[model samples]
Target: MMRLIFAAMSGALFGAGLLISGMTDPARVQGWLDIFGDWDPTLGFVMAGAILPMAVAWRIAARRAVSFTGRALPTPPNPVIDRNLVTGAVLFGLGWGIAGLCPGPAMASLGFGGLPFAVFFLSMAAGMILFGLWNRR
Candidate 1:
């Protein structure tokens, strides 16, 4: 019960952070990615702000045997740099560059962002499903 509550709170906080940081705005994201024309450094600053706390959290996590919720700690990331990894990164970058909304911000944007976001979410879901089917084969 406590773990569930904490999870919900964490999610809420994350969503709130994204909203406050202008991360939920696709235009802001697109502006940041537009390095050649009217480039905005807001996203870079946001990334830097996010990285600080995450780095501290990771350091703490590394010292822990299990999470505060009593779950086993997640394994460290694999060091491999394979074709699939590169391909996925490229695909994700392409999508992000085109749409200007990442998975987290896209989902977070759904509440305030009407029909457009709904369509984006639906399309994103379809892509995920297609990828899963392809990967399964």
Candidate 2:
């Protein structure tokens, strides 16, 4: 119950950050990717804003064996640039470039009640389910 509560609180905070940072705007994200044309630099600032705190969090987590909730802390991600990593990065970039909404922003955008966001979210979910099925084989 406490884990669920913490998860909900974390998610609410993340969604609120996305909203406050204007990351919920697809056009803004699309503009940020438009380097050859009129590129927006705001996303860089947002990225920096996210990365700095996360770096500090990583440092803190590295020194801790368990979270405040008494659960074991997750290990840091592997740094290897393997085929799966490359392929996933390419696919994620393609999706973000085409739709201007990656999974996080796409999920957040659903609160606005638009057909496009709904379609994207449903398709993304289907892809995730398919990938899980495929991965288990």
Candidate 3:
């Protein structure tokens, strides 16, 4: 019950941050990606701000003996970059460029009930489902 409450609070905070940072707007993200044209660096700053807290939290969590869940968070055994990682990254960038919304911001933006965001979120979920089905083969 406590963990569920914490999770909900954390999600709300994250969504509020995205809304406040203008990341929920696809046009803002598209502007940031438009380097050759009228590029916007605001999203870069927002990302940096977001990562700083996460990095500090990660370091603290790493040094701790156990998490709030009473279990040790396992450290990654291997962190090597591979071809699949590179391919996934390329595909992610391409999708972001074309759709103007990544998963996090897309989910956050759904509160607005806009058609474009609805379409993007539906397609994103369908793609994930298809990928899982294909991988199960």
Candidate 4:
């Protein structure tokens, strides 16, 4: 129950941050990707905003035995740049470039009315399910 509450609070905070940062806007995201054209550097600022805090958090977590909620922390990230990682990254990038919304922003943008976002969110969910089923085989 406490874990669920914390998860909900974290998710709400993330969604609020996305909304406040204008990341929920697909056009803005797409504009950031438009390097050859009119590229927007706002995403860089946002990326830095996210990365800096996470870097600090990871350093803090490195020394901690358990999380603030008294749960065991996951192991450090895998540093290997293997084929699977590259392939997955390419696919993810292509999807993000095409749709202008990754999973986080897609989930966040659902509250705003837009057929495209709805489709993207559903498709993303379906992809996750399909990937899970495929991986189990």
Candidate 5:
């Protein structure tokens, strides 16, 4: 189907962009986050490049009924700043700063990253599962 094909292409493009932009490198991510000590600006350019396309897509989304893939656009989440959101954000930032591996980049780096990546991915998955169970209870 066209939807599946488009989804695959989009994912491929996203992975390629992450690879080409050096986003797959944990060092680069850590370096960017290290604003005080030896900061890297390449990540900024990569983020800017990504934002441009997404900005246009958002504008288009606002005007459209169904997505280009023929699915209805999903409703945006409520923009409220609650305790859980704050806690989760802080936890996410801490994990990213310590591990230098956010979800997307971590998955992308799995092959080259070897044991450390495997451990991180497994731990991340376990944490997600635990959180899901906890939230459900």
Candidate 6:
């Protein structure tokens, strides 16, 4: 019950932050990415603000034994950077450039009801599914 409530609260907070930071709009994100053109540094500040709290929390978690629950926190194993990672990054960049929406913000923007976002989201989901299937083989 506590875990469920925590998850819901975390999601609500994340969505609220995205909305407050104007990250729910693809145009805003695109403007930030367009450094050569009329660049916007607002996203950088928002990202920094978000990461600062996360960094502190990570440090605390590192020092702690177990969280509020008795279960031990699992640390993620470091992944090797390989050709697949590079290729995936390039593809992600290309998609972001073309659509101006990444997975998180894209989902958040769905509240605004639009065809372009729907197309982008569906396409992104399909791509993810394809990647999962391919990786499984």
Task: Give the TM-score (vs. native) of candidate 5.
Answer: 0.92
Which structure among the candidates has the greatest lDDT? Answer: 1
On a 0 to 1 TM-score scale, where does candidate 3 land against the true structure?
0.93
What TM-score fits each model? 0.95, 0.94, 0.93, 0.93, 0.92, 0.91
Q: After best superposition, candidate 4 residue 78: deviation in angstroms?
A: 1.5
Q: Rate the local accuracy (lDDT) of all candidates.
A: 0.92, 0.90, 0.89, 0.91, 0.89, 0.86
Report RMSD (Å) for each prediction in the order shown.
1.0, 1.2, 1.3, 1.2, 1.4, 1.6
For TM-score, the strongest prediction is 1
Across residues 1-137, which tens digit of lDDT does each residue of candidate 6 receive? 88889888988899889989978777888899999999999999999999999889888888888887666876765688899889989999888877778888888878784898888889999999998999899
Error of 6 at 122 (Å): 1.0
Model 5, 1-137: lDDT tens digits are 99889888988898788888988888888999999999999999998999999999989999999997679997986988999999999999999999888898778777777999899999999999999999998
Candidate 1 similarity to native, TM-score: 0.95
True-structure lDDT of candidate 4: 0.91
Off by over 4 Å in 1: none
- Which of candidates 3 and 5 is the stronger one according to TM-score? 3
How big is the RMSD of model 6? Answer: 1.6
Better of 1 and 5 by TM-score: 1
lDDT per residue for candidate 1 within 37-83, as digits (tens), equals: 99989989899999999999999999999998789988989999999
Model 4, range 47-126, lDDT digits (tens) per residue? 99999988999999999999998999998778878998899999999999987888899999898848988999999999
**Alpha-carbon deviation at 55 in model 1, angstroms:** 0.9
Clashing pairs in 5: none
Error of 1 at 135 (Å): 1.6
Better-scoring candidate (lDDT), 2 or 6: 2
